[model samples]
Target: MKTLSFDGQRPCILQTASSVGKKEGEGNLTPFYDNIFQDAYLGEKSWEKAESKLLKTNLKTLLEKANESPENIDIVFGGDLLNQCISSNYGLLDFHIPFLGLYGACSTFVEGMILAAMAVHGNYAQKAIALTSSHFCSSERQFRFPLEYGGQRTPTSQWTVTGSGAALIAKGGEIEITHATIGRIIDYGISDINNMGAAMAPAAIETIRRHFQDRNLPNDYFDLVVTGDLGSVGKQITQQQLKNYGLDLEDRYIDCGDKIFDKEKQDAHAGGSGCGCCASVFSGWLYYLLRTGKCRRILLTATGALMSPTSSFQGESIPGIAHCISIERKTDNQ
Candidate 1:
């Protein structure tokens, strides 16, 4: 079975925190963000260092909100879009906590959460942190072009979000991590780097389908079924493909990419992308809704286009993966 149920003392999302750059701060969900920086460089010498600072700020906010010291957190799982995951490495070094870095592209946050929850559930750690970040300036230089080039973006292209989000998972809280489904890498021969939505939609569809089947749950089981960084194109493709499989998501379906920014106003061609797109949205707005009881159940499936600049340069098709986790408001009876 692809899905695993944490039947024993399900791990809880104790707290969440987020920090974003000016562009993301201008988005509709900015009100929920913990910190916002007007400067893209975040007072650092380079975009890379700024990204590292963004991640550090997010973790610091999370620790403060949870009122826990670094010693209280047994382990931390984090990653980013930067080469060698420098953002998470340098950002978290000050905390002096044990760290395990991951690389799942845009799906990194969900990947970290799954690992953290599993660690707590298995008694490996009493508290664990799942975090990720991305910076637009840094990502563009690495994956596309440098800031000086002023490259034009395609309509299908997405803007990488400059932000970070962190979540603390422990044994007790109002929101429980109930189940999770690991995704399989699906490549449909899509080589266009700009059209990530098309390349990743298949994997999102497959993971959602498998989760529903494995859990014997209906389409409407979750109050909301959200995908990470699919933007407009990928969201449309996922909805259409799932319908073909006889599953109707209806209005409960949403994508973090689409939710984070206003396409028309923000000039975000397709919408937001990158690790921070989903991470910030989930840790900020979505967490608020769950905490306030506006939402009872949520299925967060973060998708990633698993391709590097080298792979794309070599004309290799992009492979996509997604990981789904179920978060439910703990009922009084439960």
Candidate 2:
């Protein structure tokens, strides 16, 4: 249970931008996104290439928003669901900034942000960009069925989100990165690829619990506690798990997956799941909330299932991990 409590000057969130596809743009937080393309391809030849464009456009948009250029970014931390994180690798190829690619499945955004914040806060860099992206077509081909297959999806299956988000972290700003909790991998023997919610709920619960314990804070310490891609099913499981632990999070808990689509009309059985799910939502809605004083503090626990097609085919259970970071509105209260 390793948790880091950041002290002194925390790295600041200077800017953030989210670029989502048509469906997500039509979702609950549509107004918060920086850009939305009606075409999933985004004028790219293939799905993977489209995803790469998503990242590129997102980072470019973030820089534009911050009134900076690629040269101002000391380094970039990014990842995607694609093998070897090729999407991030090639997406950022044109940039002159040093890149450190990472992979944490759906949790890649927070993983990158944590590392980027560390680099900036430790004085190793004056500024850094944290980015992650995912696409429906690309993720489907790699993780599950092909688009042409039209495979009948199980009711528990979640739709892969198509989007990307990038955030600029600098040495000073109004939004501070406060603390982080690095999760442990835990597998409860769930092998159903469609039921990722069930597979990942326990990991979210564990990480959230450990975070609270490590920080010696109660559930209400933060105005909001957000989870990545846990959808409705995983949300229920996590809520129940917290209840079992004598902690109730009903008031301030929100799952990014649950907010990405309308369950009644969208037919997104379990809701959304992908690296972009949390990335876009956080960059858009959550970032706005924090910046505008609607939320004073938030605990963002992005969860990821460390499983692959090979592992699933080999009858291996899906192991889950959750990474948490606290974001707060900077003030002179201290």
Candidate 3:
């Protein structure tokens, strides 16, 4: 079975923090974020350094909110969109905590959480932290073109979010990590670099279906089913495709990409993308809903397009992957 259930001493999210750049700060979820930087550079010399700073700021805020110091965290799982995962490496260097870096493209946030939860559940760590970040400037340059080029964007293109999110996990909390489903890579022969939503939708659907089947859950079991950075195009595709499998999401489904920005007002073409898109939204808005008991159960499936510039240039198709985790609000009966 691809899905694993945390039946004993379930890991829980004790606290969370989100920090975003200037453009993201102006979006619809402004009030939910912990910190909003007025400058994209964050007073740093380069965009990469700024992204590292953003991640560090979020981790600091998470620790402060949990009233725990760096020494209390047993391990940290983190990553970013940059090459070599430098954002997480440098950002967490000063904290002197044990770190394990990961790379799952836009799905890094949920990937980190799954590993962190597993660590705590297996008694490998008493306290673990999951962190991820991405910057529009940095990702744009690496994945597409440099910002100075002023390239024309297609309507299907998505704006990479500039933000970071961190969560502190412990043995007990208000929100429990109940189950997790790791996804498999799925490709539909999509090659357009700009249309990542189309490339990743199939993978999200596969993971969602497997999760429901493995757990013997009904289609409407979860209060909400959210995807990581599918943007508007992928969200639509997922909704349409899932119906063929006898699952109807209807209004109960939403995409983090869609929720991160105001589609009508914001200039974001299709919507938000990148690792931080879902990271910030989950840590900020979704966390608020779960913490406040507004949402009882949620299935968070983070999607990612596993393609590189070199691979794209070689005419290779983009393969997509998604990882799902089920979170539930603690109740008196349980």
Highest-scoring model, lDDT: 1
TM-score to true structure, per model: 0.99, 0.98, 0.98
Cα lDDT of all candidates, in order?
A: 0.94, 0.90, 0.92
The regions of model 3 sitting more than 4 angstroms off are none
Ten-residue segment with the worst summed lDDT in candidate 1? 325-334
Query: Candidate order by lDDT, highest to lowest?
Result: 1, 3, 2
Better of 1 and 2 by TM-score: 1
C-alpha RMSD by candidate, in order: 0.9, 1.0, 1.0
- CA error at residue 30 for candidate 1, angstroms: 1.7
lDDT of 2 at 242: 93
Question: For candidate 3, what is the TM-score?
Answer: 0.98
Q: How close is candidate 1 to the true structure, as a TM-score?
A: 0.99
lDDT tens per residue, model 2, 75-149: 999999999998998899998789988989998899988998889889999999999999999998998877889
Question: What is the alpha-carbon lDDT for the whole of candidate 1?
Answer: 0.94
Better of 1 and 3 by lDDT: 1
lDDT of 2: 0.90
